[model samples]
Target: MFLLKTLTILVAIVVIIGAVTLASKKAVHHDGLEIEDLNKRYRMMANAVKQAVMKKEAWKKEAKAEKIRAKGDDRSDTKPIAFVIDFKGDLKASAAASLREEVSTVLEVARPDDKVVVRLENYGGVVHEHGLAASQLSRVRER
Candidate 1:
């Protein structure tokens, strides 16, 4: 029993050390979603909502309008853009790096009329880490 307990404790220590080492490493990535793709998704959702609210007979006329809208002809001027970023924060706010990258990308291409929306989920952990995350978000506003 003594030997078994010793081995278990050793294994646990090793696992904890490995986790800490990995957590200390910096890992950041950035990915941008195309405006066209977002528009497609918005149209799909709008279609679903329209289908739910309107009678089937009304669909034909709406569908024609949808086609024109889909063709990108409803506007004579530039349409405003929206940039969306998602961040999931943990005890260390490890996602802050990715958030920084995403914000940088948006700032590079976003116009004055463009908007940035960050969908954030945080466990509300260490003060320093959360502050870092908040600073990352503030970059968007500063731009």
Candidate 2:
């Protein structure tokens, strides 16, 4: 669309220049002020057209992303055959709660034959927090 718009603008500018040169029969010289004015106006219009086309493309992409997000909200009873768990956080009580919730959600949606992969990264904090997180990953393996 942008390409077509740009080409159209370019063609319009060419036609405008041709008409201006033909109309100013007595002063069609290159050094004439009217020619310069026509060139400036053409450039300005082309730039404006380009900017508007870019804005339209951006809006289209945003709308497409919104549609995908809306579609993803629908849930089905069938569980996925494979799953992955991403565990990356400091070893704190707050982090532990977040990790626990993520694990529990995965387990709920995961099928019996599904597999979970946890990427553990620990920054020393409460010992119990890390212990609980390790236990969560171990539970995945036990199943």
Candidate 3:
């Protein structure tokens, strides 16, 4: 019981400090977020790491990657898009409304080959809330 109380106090202090820090550092201008090309980011990071390798091995690795890329790219077709959405949930599942909107938008443009990727971060919650959240996802398949 004493240890629990101490932990609770420490957590409360951390929460207070975190809230203050976030309030002070919050974005003043709410310009929209940029869409990053993850594939490009991976390629750039790989190239940077390759530059640090021993010279002969780096050349060999680069050649192998290039060969695989060339073989994969020898097609004249559109690339399938992966739409990624994040869901941070609570007991009440308040975020489901926003999730519904995101799913609707993705469904509008999503082709059969395109993908809707959801990164769910919900600790187990009330049954009804989970059901609601699940139905929103079902809309994606219903389309």
Candidate 4:
């Protein structure tokens, strides 16, 4: 009888302790703006963390790839690398011609070995003017 009574008391104590723990668990609430701000902050933090992880993983993969490539490179010789430039435009006031200075600056940096591939796609303008513009690009190619 004493053991039974003691067991009952112990069970009651355990139940009360469990109830207290459950009751003590806290919940959070916020107003709309506060919730929105919190969500924005969380998104920013999550994005930062994601970017950091991605950078770390990318560096690891790049290092591993470089190591593999270096191993193979020992048996090969470096060849001259080539580049091709693809120019495109439309016959509008906002065409590449408006940026001639900027484009010239880019062309000035090009090595003589570089090849340029111009694609003419102007469909809206003085139709004959596009022909003249394309001819100028051909002049650049000859040079």
Question: What's the TM-score of every candidate structure?
Answer: 0.63, 0.40, 0.59, 0.35
lDDT, candidates in the order shown: 0.81, 0.68, 0.80, 0.55
- Model 4: how far is 102 from its true place, Å? 5.1
Q: Could you give candidate 3's per-residue lDDT for residues 1-143 as a string of tens digits?
A: 99999999999999999999898888564433335777778977877687777597777888688779968975454778888888999988877777877787778888888887888999877888788789988887675
For each of the candidates, the C-alpha root-mean-square deviation to the true structure, in angstroms, is 9.0, 26.7, 9.8, 21.6
- Residue-level lDDT tens digits of model 2 in 1-143: 99999999999999999999888995754431111334446756865676576687775686577568758966565644545455666646456666677777778877786767676666688887778877787777777
- Candidates 3 and 4 compared by TM-score, better number: 3
Error of 2 at 98 (Å): 1.2
Off by over 4 Å in 3: 1-34, 54-77
Better of 2 and 4 by TM-score: 2
- Report RMSD for candidate 1: 9.0
Query: Model 3: C-alpha RMSD to truth?
Result: 9.8
Point out where model 4 deviates above 4 Å.
1-63, 67-88, 91-93
Between candidates 1 and 2, the lDDT winner: 1
lDDT of 2 at 70: 57
Question: What does candidate 1's lDDT look like per residue over 1-143, in tens digits?
Answer: 99999999999999999988787764443355434467778778988999899999898789988787668866534788778888888987777777777788889988888898988888877888788778978888887
Worst 10 residues of 3 by lDDT: 27-36
Query: Backbone clashes in each candidate structure, one number apiece?
Result: 0, 0, 0, 0
Model 4 worst lDDT run, 10 consecutive residues? 28-37
